[model samples]
Target chain A: MSTGDFIFTGLGHAYLKDNWIFRNYRGEAVRGQVLALLGPNGSGKTTLLKILLGALTPSEGSVNIQGQVAFVPQLFQVAFDYTALDMVLMGRAKKVGLFSQPTPADEEAAINALERMGIGHMAYRPFHEMSGGQRQLVIFARALVAEADILILDEPTSALDLKNQNGILEWIDRLARRENLTVIFSTHHPHHAYAVADQALLMLGENDFESGPVGDVLTEKNLLQLYGLPLKRLTFDYEDLNVETLVPVFRNCKRRKAN
Target chain B: MTEKTVKQEKFSACSSGRFRRWLPKTPLARPWILGLILLIAIIGSLFMGAYPIPWHRILEILLNSVWPFSGSESAYLDLREITVVTLIRPPRILVAVLAGIALGMSGTALQGMMRNPLVGPDLVGVTSGAAFGAVLAMWLGFLYTPVILVLSTIGGIAAMLGTMALARVVGGRNDSLPLILAGFFIGAFFLAGVGLLIYLENPFYPKGQRTGNIIYWLLGTFRGAGPVKAWTIAVPTIVGGTVLMGLRWRLNLLSLGDLDASSLGINLNRLRWILITVVSLMVAGQVAVSGVVGWVGLIIPHAARMLVGPDHRRLIPASAMLGGLFVLGLDNFTRTVIWSEVPVGVLSAIFGTPLICFLFWKTKTKGWNE
Candidate 1:
């Protein structure tokens, strides 16, 4: 299928009867293009993604995603003690018959994904023992192993370090370019959108939002409005540094006032 | 790499490979292994009891009992030995095995559904609910075992629904701790109801009434268990277990959290209802037959996970087999090793605690949830 074949639209979603989580949200998410959704936390970024993923039903609008979509959840809740390979095999759940055990091919596919992510050595590691960032990578690999035409990631690099974050972004960028996989990701970071997104979706509020090419939606005015801050997107000498290096600078927002 | 990272990598390498390699290859293998051991243990179970039957004779009697048409023209193959093997031993062993399998898979399913290792009938109100129902039926002079079974099953399912509904009220993902809390409170509510019923029954009891017997059975037992009860419990547990195995993918998806499951083409609401109903049915049937055997459901899953990886395809069947073996083994111990017939429930508590503690200790090095 072509990249622009499917369009995702959300009519609305309300958390309570009155309080709208998202409303009248209409957007076209194309295949083969990386779409980055940017908004403040709890501002319906994840909710919009969930709607697109068909996880949540929009109260007022409709959502349509074409073809099979693989999702990398923001936080994975694992109760059972599964292995890294076991977790990766879960990505193939849609393909494998319900009663069918993981075939050798499935295992090989999982192994390959882990290896490509530089986590081949930890393929047999207990999932619970891995670091948060490492677990996130495994979850990403899980999404990738599905070989779904559309990959939806929710803050995939939120927990990663500098190197891993860059590695993941590069991997995602390459996947979108080469494999022609449509990618939809949600993040709070403006730079991340600038770096990886072909199209940026700015959820303005419960009632307002905009979607366009990355530069247009990630402009200073839109980001400032979205964050509700007097924000400036300044170029720094540490541009070479990945997003993780900027985490301390970004996370210490209250410290700026103290200074 | 940092020293910590290197250590972690080294630790992970050996640990993951060794554990994965150690896991049982086929789901069938665990049961085969456990079944073989349990067969031997059943022979041991038969050897026990007041009669000091020889192993060879026990085997002969067992074979004759099962294969009555086999042309064994031995005078010693009489009704008493047949009664020992067929009437007494088989029914009792069957009950124990069924109870174990039921509790084991129930725990496995509940743990998977709730995503909590600590949750089971005891913590989740199913046991107490069924106990109250069974006790109420008995105290009300319902002499029929089938009636007690029906009442207890309904009671257990009702309690599970109430607990789940309470979780729904809390308004978050249906998680382990919240469901546990819901079960705890609901269980306590049912306990109070049982207590009130007992208080009411006290006025009608004649001298030497043994009111405590009802309470003791609720603690759990395998006494006076017959084949009828075995079939009643076994059918539902086996059927429910089959369905659970069928929905392994959905269960695994749910393990990723509700939203993740929905996105992956699982109809979350439909599945949630189906799984809860099926699980409740199995648990109710089990509670009806065996009062409320504890730990098997909670501990068996962990044990099964250790043997087979947490892939439900393997974990579910393995849990069922190992559970059956564990319970039968414990019941055999309760029957033969002691002067008094100790119930399997009490023994499981006595035994399962130490094993669980050791499990926790063993997995402390590697993350348990992993």
Candidate 2:
């Protein structure tokens, strides 16, 4: 099956009655590609994500989504002790009838998704009792079980440790390539985007944004302008491996004199 | 394929050992057990009453009433005994069961929708609003049962809408604290209205009639439940309960919060309103028949959640049956244990409060942290 794509033309959104948060934003996320959205705090990344998910109607412009989309939020708080499998099974809500329970086929799909995410052992564990990273993995499993053409995640790796962050990023990349799924995710780290993203959409502000391949859009200059902080790129070569890392340069230091 | 088989084996291996011994093997078994207990409770209730009737005689009266040709040799079955069994006792017990189911299902729905275990019809002002409407009907001399049912149903919907509006005004959408706070004020407001109606009793009527109606409205009892009242409560409860049960899976998604639910193809606002209306109707039906019975809606759903996990498909039915059993048992206690009949509401609170407290203590350490 061919993957699906989302094309947005002149998209805009406003909070409250008419106060515009972002306007005239345009981008296209192609099928079988990972689009990384980068923005500072209060930069309307979530609002843009909401517009794509059809949770909010944009005031100006239109978006064409090719197929069904699933979202994995940053965190999920379950007030009751639903097992991890039960939580993943909810992804089949669109497929299940209104009054019907999840069938064995659905359960098998959920279990397969969890196993794909390498969390099959956690299927019977209570979702609320699992650690934060494990819970996030289960949520990813939910999105995988949905089998949506487009997967949208809002800061999926923000709360995770370094290892978990890499694990989730690797899964996103693998899912995009192997399953031919369209993936759009927002993150605070530019290096993460560089590591796995095929394309980048940088939200500068209303009427000012950048969207292109990761190689062109995630430069040191663009990264510096995005967060207004000095950054230095360092390359390490050990044996047959070469790694490039971005480090923030702290230039100004003024020691307080003791009274 | 190899990995898939290994994973499948691990899945069953993980599930098989962790299944609790106390819990039933499947979701279906728990409901059957609850149904059996409810049947036992109903029969036991039939046996223990002010009038001491033998179990065999009760069965004979029930069968003879159902089929006239099934005649017993004993002609000593008095009309009083037959009437008491067929007419008086059954209706009251049925009313209790219906009210319990309504309250229990509504509680489960509201708690799931709100994503808070502590919420119920009474806490959210639906019961109080219905109580006020019933009391108003009584004071206005419009004491017809259907009138009370309609007015109370409207009152409950109004109260629920008012709470939503107030929550919007106080905090942004999808804020639980503001909704609970709004419910608190609305409950107090309707309660005050009920109290005012009690204060302004009609002098043309006997003092006992006015005071007695007020007592029934404030502290719920199934005392005067007849076949008409029982059936009146049954229709709405059945309809509303069915709708709630059908929306059980949706409720599970809703408890995941608005953003997550919307992403899963659920129309969050529409689902929320439908749930609120269904819950209001159930609460109103129960309040119309039995005045503002507390704690059944709150405690029974929690108990059911503990028995069966948070899957609402199982939770809703379990809660409804357990609710029926709970109120039926309590009503029996009220009728048989005391020299004078005590309000079932008072008894429910006496039992429900400690259980809720224990649940609060139990679930406090888990579940709340994000």
Per-residue CA lDDT of model 1 for A145-165, tens digit only, reads: 887778888998887877878
lDDT of 1 by residue, B1-370 (tens): 3543654543332223323333444444455666677667766676666556666777777676678766466466667766776688777788888788778877787777766677776778888787778778877877466777777777778888888889778755455567878989999998888888766775556733636767667667888778777787777887887888787656666676776665565566776676777777777677677776887777888887777767776677778888888988888787777988776778889999999888778778766454
Q: Candidate 2: where are CA atoms >4 Å away?
A: A1-3, A16-19, A234-245, A252-259, B1-29, B54-56, B66-73, B172-175, B202-208, B367-370
Interface RMSD (Å) of model 2?
4.6
**Compared with the true structure, what per-residue lDDT tens digits does model 2 show for residues A1-259?**
2348888988888886667777777788778999999999999999899989988888889999998899988767776778888899999989987767677788889989999888887777778778778887898789888888999989988998899898888889988998788999999988888878889998987778888998788877887888898766768997898976677655564653546
In model 1, the runs with Cα more than 4 Å from the true position are A1-10, A97-100, A112-121, A131-133, A228-259, B1-31, B66-73, B76-79, B139-142, B171-175, B202-213
Where is the poorest 10-residue window by lDDT in model 1 chain B?
A: B11-20
Candidate 1 lDDT at A91 equals 82
Pairs in steric clash, model 1: A3-A31, A11-A60, A11-A61, A12-A59, A12-A61, A81-B370, A82-B370, A128-B370
lDDT of 2 by residue, B206-289 (tens): 876787767865698999899778987999999998888788888889898777888988777888888888888888888888
Docking class of 2: acceptable
- List the candidates' TM-scores in order: 0.85, 0.91
